[model samples]
Target: MNEFRHVTVLLRETVSALRPRPGGHYLDGTAGGGGHTGLLLEKIQHTGRIEALDRDPDAIAALKKRFAGEPAVTVTQGNFFQAARLFPHPGFHGILLDLGVSSHQLDTPERGFSFHTSAPLDMRMEQDGPTARDLVNTLDEPSLRRILRDYAQEKYAPQIARAMVAQRSAAPIETTTQLADLIAAAVPAAYRREGHPARKTFMALRYACNGELDGLEEALLSLFNLLQPEGRLAVITFNSLEDAAMKRAARQLTAGCTCPPEFPVCVCGKSPRAHSLKPVFPSPEEIERNPRARSAKLRVLERR
Candidate 1:
């Protein structure tokens, strides 16, 4: 395993949104490489406890080793979506969720997250279950097209799906380079000039293989429910799909009433449970240093 050196995006802003206190309990839901966890630990000053969780075994191992003998930190190997079951007794003062693939995952060629390098088509964050190769070879043409279109919003989804199906009939597409070449050939030369033609296709496959968006709503709701009164939840999303979901979740949590306009009496009896804070974006200097931070957006909400 290579050294997990992840550049934490919007570091200062995320911590500020969390509003960590000396005695407050924190949750680093996606503790990739422990960059954010380290900052949280510093703010808490050994007075608070942090429960850091990650689905990747490599990340968990790295975190355990990094924070060894630290009485304030607890590292766990699990998905943040299953956090509700993972931590039954929840009174979290703040929770941080940096959603999407980490820099370490994309840099590792064997992980098959990047098209720049040649490796097996395995994009599982947890390193289990069906891989990208399995999905590329086994899924039917329509299903493949749907994944590309829905998950990645790829415009050439149908063409790419047809090309993949036709090529796999001859031999299994077992590597990242093979799939990249296939996608490049499926799209036009002009289209390829805009960006790596395989980028969207690869993203769709990874999302589908890991079921990334399936339980996102439930997970966000679960985290929100776990917050202590006036506690904050900070989330950093990379793409529009995730941003839209977070916005909707925040709005739903902060919505006040559902009673009819004509009915004067309050029938629903529902009150706003949370409120959204101003969103934060990376500065020009930050994006210049880390291009991956270019698309990052951080949104926060506080329990009422």
Candidate 2:
């Protein structure tokens, strides 16, 4: 296996904003390699505690080794969106979610998230979940088009989805290389090589396979009662879709009413749940070292 060299993006800024207290409880929702969790635990050495969660088994195993015999830590294997159910704690002082695919997953050919390398069309963050191949091969043209258009915002979604449906009839699209070639053929030759044509299709498929955006809203709602008063919930999102969801959730949680703007008097009984701290971005220095951090956006909420 290749060495896991994930340089946790937005490391300094994320940990610094956390401002962890010695006796407080914290959680790292996506503990890839334990990079951020390691720092959080170090801050909590004598009095605080850390609960680390990861969907990837390998990451769980690696983190277990990295934090072994540390009474200050607890490691769990599963989606962080399901955290409230998994953790025994009624509330926590701090929570950090780094929502991005790890460098190890992308660089490993067998996992198939990158166009630079040819591999199986498997993009499961969890090893056992349904993969890109299954979605591409089984969904109807209209369904595929909706996924591409809605999730990836691909302008040529209809044409690409049509072509995919027609091609897969001959045989199942089994490999990432084959799928990439098919998407290239679907796009106009004049537009070819401007960027990988398969990029959007792959992203849409992965999002659908993982049901990423589907459960996000509810997860945020669940976390509202799970954070202690004055506790912080920090989320780091990689794309606009995820960022938008987080933004809307925070707004809803913090705002006093969902009533129409024309309303002169308060009717809706919804009170403010949390306050939105301004969203933070990666520093140019951090982006220079890791270009993948370029699009990352971090939004934090403080329970009221």
Best by TM-score: 1
lDDT of 2 at 240: 91
The lDDT of model 2 is 0.84
Pairs of residues at least 3 apart in sequence or in different chains that clash in candidate 1: none
TM-scores for all predictions:
0.99, 0.94
CA shift at 180, candidate 2, in angstroms?
0.9
Candidate 2 lands at a TM-score of: 0.94
Model 1 misses residue 200 by how many Å? 0.6
